[model samples]
Target: MSLETIDLSVTIGDKQILNNMTIKLERGEVLILMGPNGSGKTTLAFALLGHPKYQINKGKIILDNNDITDYPTYQRALMGLGLAFQNPVEIPGLRLSMLLNAIQMKKSGSSFDISSIDPKLIIWARNKTRELGLQPSFLEREVNVGFSGGEKKRSEMLQILTMDPKYIILDEPDSGLDVDGIKLIGETIDSLRSAGKGILIITHHAEITKFVSPDKVMIMSKGKIVDEGGIELIKKIEEYGYKDYEGVQ
Candidate 1:
């Protein structure tokens, strides 16, 4: 019933990235993984998704009771696990709607082909884009190409909505967003929670807490969890920063 990592250590190239990282993301809950830069927050996110380069030195990745530590990235995604990159890449020829249609087809187990947009698919994409404050025309543009920072984030969110994974990993979703953009993202998170989706939001700033207070907060340092508690931990980090939090468990 949870996506859990046990004694999960990861390495990239010759250097160790995560140190026995144990964590849980339960259904219908938000778990905040906060840390400073190079604290291995993103590493843990990628490791959980079974990224190829992030070799799992030891430990297990269990999702809904299935051991996925050895599963490939595509298999992990098929098992209802999804990760949103901190920096989304651009696709020059493919349209955003095309990508969304492809995800929808795969998610629903339909035959995959994108010769033309289905009318229903276009309607759905248009509605989602409008909800994100994007013009309908944005859906026709090439994926992430020539998009503003906020637009790109919204585009990523739209893809997530189409995919509709059971669990979501958002890596610094609010990083470059303005006030309005952050609020939009907060609303989207609220919707996801209401839909009973488990979320792991990896972020350095506590600003996101104002809109969506996490059920639990884990402070990560030096690639290991240093502290864990309720919302109070976020407040403490906001007040004093990670300087006093290392090795304080």
Candidate 2:
């Protein structure tokens, strides 16, 4: 049972973005991919979710032994693949509450009043908003519209929780969080791991590594994985820097 990419190479326009990258995240484990800017961490996230802009030159995306290499983005999501964006986008004219209701409609074939969301979902959303240090009133705001960085991240989590995909890809989730926010994220991640969701966290910041002890850490350089190991690899990278792993096979 795994969500993985095998021998994947991707290119955008005439420029190659990823080169024969292979990554695997088993159920109930957390894998961290760390790299400096332009190392293709975000590109991997996009490719895994089947973003059309990234052309797959060759590779296979296997989700729970199912070949989803050619699956569309929404199809991949419906098949239990999920992502939390590093920079969440705002959708004008769309209330967060309304979006949750829409997701329920799409996923469960559930229907409800357009004016009122399911009461249970509202309660859950309210609790989640509070747990993420957001006021329940946020459920009423337009998605990511007028939200602070921390708030947008929390909003993304709320949606992810509602969807509850089995495999989660979080793109720099701790990028702009304070201590409390980071701790809350750590707790959320721990819960997800316990619930048996395979998670891949992409980040260059080591602060997030302090909160959760990952099963494996991968160092990506110039679109390829250069080094991979346990937590010790993180410490080494911290001391000697990513320069040590550059051009390393």
Candidate 3:
């Protein structure tokens, strides 16, 4: 399975946030998007999930060869598309397990059973939480209600594992993480890659590439992908930063 964006562009009023951006992630491949702040990385992510604020002025978002640019967020979720937000909102009165059970039912189309839930999922989540230095109790709390930055990212990662979608788009998974937190996030991506999941990771930090060894790297600036290359580009960015590369004003 694959997700491809063809000549994608998004505009809000007179501001064009993304300009003819094209990107593709095949099954089991991880692609990293690197750019400075306001470079439209998040804009592209939100557009893929069909956010109402960012208007899809022109372009098509295709998942597994089916157009999904006009599909609602929930519909897209049901179609094997998952998004891990940069800043997840706090939903009061919602337990983490309850949310997971709902998503589990949606994906597997089976009756919710905490006892019969997939062992692999529970094991992975347990291991990930331990690896991230989080308490097991963290998983039982409300979603992002009072989570720290690191906790929130780990929570999002757990959901991704549970959903096990065909395509996963993560926006800035490394932003507020410390060394261990970042490592856990990288390990999670590596696990997903090994399982043949298509991943699109939006991040500015080059350290994340060390963990997942991205197949492709797309550099965005002013809402356009100005450069695309391999892991070597990640090294160059580490040495010289985005200013040394082309297309940034």
Candidate 4:
């Protein structure tokens, strides 16, 4: 009934990026993963989503009591797991609407004529874009092409809304955003959490935490979770910094 990583260890080629990591993300809760650079936060996100580059040396990924350690990326998505990348890739020829339509088909497990697709779905996507403060014309443009930092993040949000996965992983979602952009993204995340979705957000900054309160905050260092606590932990990191936790478990 939950997405859990048990004793997870990930390696890329000869280098080990994550070591004996274990965590659980439950339904209707928000978990924030925070760490300095190279602490394996993004690596954990990639491994959880079955990214090929992150080799799971040991441990299991269970989603709703189903072991998905061997599942492929697309299969994980089909199982209601979604990941929003820190740096979303730009597809020059793929229009936003086209990508959303493809996601809808994948979610429904069936394909119909483009014209026969549900009009309400299209309207929903449009409304999501508008709600995120994006222009309607963005639906016609190529995905992530010529998008500003905030626009790119909003685009990722649009995809997340369209997919409607059971569990969501967002990596550095607040990076490169201005004040207003951060506020908008924070509100969007708040709405998602209120909707009872399991969410794991990765970030180094504490600004976003001001808007969206997480149920748990985990600090990572050198591929291990160094410390875990509530809001007090975030305040400690902001004041004392991560120097004391550099290599300590």
Candidate 5:
């Protein structure tokens, strides 16, 4: 089973952002997508997750063997797809604890009933917060509200851990993180990879590669994958930049 995009093309209004792009992510593997700015990396991530704004002008998104190109965002989540946004939104009044509980219920296919949840789940969440180096009290705060950049990344990890999705799409998870924060995020990603989850990481700066070894790397330009290779491709890009691949098809 795999998360596969076949000949995918996307547009926003009249302008095209992705053009005949295709990629595959299998379970128990990590695929890193790197590109210069405006290369449509984020657009591909959004299209995979069924973002309404990214109109799929062509191609299909396959989850396992199911064609999910037309699935709603919530449906995709239920099909074991998860995305950690680059800029997580702040919900002023919604507590993090509440959100986690909701996600747990959705994953379990159970009716929403906070009163029926086991006490152990609450304990488990608190333990996760501490393990991620977050304060136990942070779980009580509104989701991402007033969180620092590092805190926001950690918070997103908290959700991913709790949900335990089959495939995860992380958009620039290393951005805005300090050295220690990057280590923490990298460790979290390693743990998930060890658990046999498929991961797709999109980044402009390849800093996270130092911590987590990606199985394959793809470079994008003009919304298409220009080149793909093993980890060595990352090093090449780091040294020479995307100049040589600017208009490659």
Candidate 6:
């Protein structure tokens, strides 16, 4: 599977968030997007997920060889596109298990028979929770309601792992996570990649890059990808901050 953006651009009100942004993500590969705050990392993620706020002024988004630039958000999701927001909204009154079951139904197009649901799903959720150092009871609680930063990250991972999307875009998954939380997110993402899913992560902390082992890195500045390279760039960014690159390549 693959995702490609061809000269994609977006604007809100009088500000242009993304300008001629083009990127490609292939199967079993992880791409890390790095930039300063307000460099359009989240905007790009939202655009890919077909958010209604960010209007696509020009360009096309092709996913798995299908041109879905015009598809609605739900249509894109049905086509196997998934997003983990930088600030995920809390969906009250919805149990984590129930949400996962709903995703399972959506993916398999199966009847809404909870009895027919695979028992292994529970095991899978349990294992992921343990791996993320979360409590098993989290799966029984309302989705993200009163959850801590780490717990919310775990919830996002659980949803993605269950959905098993072909192309997964994580918008700043490391935003509010600690050391352990970052490691857990990395492990979950690696697990997904091993299953043949392409991953795109938007992050600012180069420290988190150590966990994910990204195949490619893109640096966004002033509404566009100005620099791109291999993992070595991540090391360079960490050792010498991004300011060194300002006004000089």
Would you estimate the TM-scores of all the predictions?
Answer: 0.96, 0.96, 0.90, 0.96, 0.96, 0.92
- Model 5: per-residue Cα lDDT over 1-249, one tens digit each: 799999999998889999988899999899999999888988898899999999999999999999999999999999999999988999999889988998998888988886665567789999999988799899889999999988898899899888889999999888989887788888788878898999999987677887888988999999999999988998898899988996677
* lDDT per residue as tens, model 1, 1-249: 899999999999989988898899999999998888899988998998888999999999999999999999989998999888898999999988889888888887888988856789889889989998899999889999999887888888888888889999999888888888888888798779889999999887777888888989998988889989988988888899988966654
Residue-level lDDT for 222 in candidate 1: 88
Candidate 6 lDDT over 1-249, as tens digits, reads 689999999987667789999999998999999877887889999899888888899899999889988889978998999998788789999888888988888788886765555678888888877877888899889999999876787788778878788999998888788898888788778878888889999987876766778989998877888888988877777888677556632
Off by over 4 Å in 6: 111-119, 244-249
Candidate 5 segments exceeding 4 Å error: 114-118
- Cα misplacement distance, residue 30 of candidate 1 (Å): 0.4
Whole-model lDDT, model 1: 0.89
TM-score of candidate 1 against the unseen true structure: 0.96
Whole-model lDDT for model 6 versus the true structure?
Answer: 0.85
The stretch of ten residues in a row with the least summed lDDT in candidate 5 is 113-122
Candidate 2 local lDDT, 5-119, one digit each (tens): 9999999887899999988999999998998898899999999998899989999889999999999999999899999998898999999999988887778865555876789
For candidate 5, the TM-score is: 0.96
**Which scores greater on TM-score, model 5 or model 6?**
5
Return the candidate ranking by lDDT, descending: 5, 4, 1, 2, 3, 6
Model 4 agreement with the true structure over 1-249: per-residue lDDT tens digits: 689999999999989999998899998889999899988999999999998999999999999999999999999999999999999999999888888888898788887445555678778887888888898789989999999887898899889989999999999889988887788888888888899899999987788987899999999999998888897888888899998897697
Flag the better candidate by lDDT, 3 or 4: 4
Against the true structure, candidate 3 reaches a TM-score of: 0.90
lDDT tens string, model 3, 20-134?
Answer: 9888899999999988888898888888888888899899999998999999988888888889999999988887776777787778778666555566656666676677678
Cα lDDT for residue 30, model 5?
A: 92
How many collisions per candidate?
0, 0, 0, 0, 0, 0
For model 2, what is the error of residue 34's alpha carbon versus the real structure, in angstroms, after optimal superposition?
0.3
Which stretches in model 3 have alpha-carbon errors above 4 Å?
110-128, 245-249
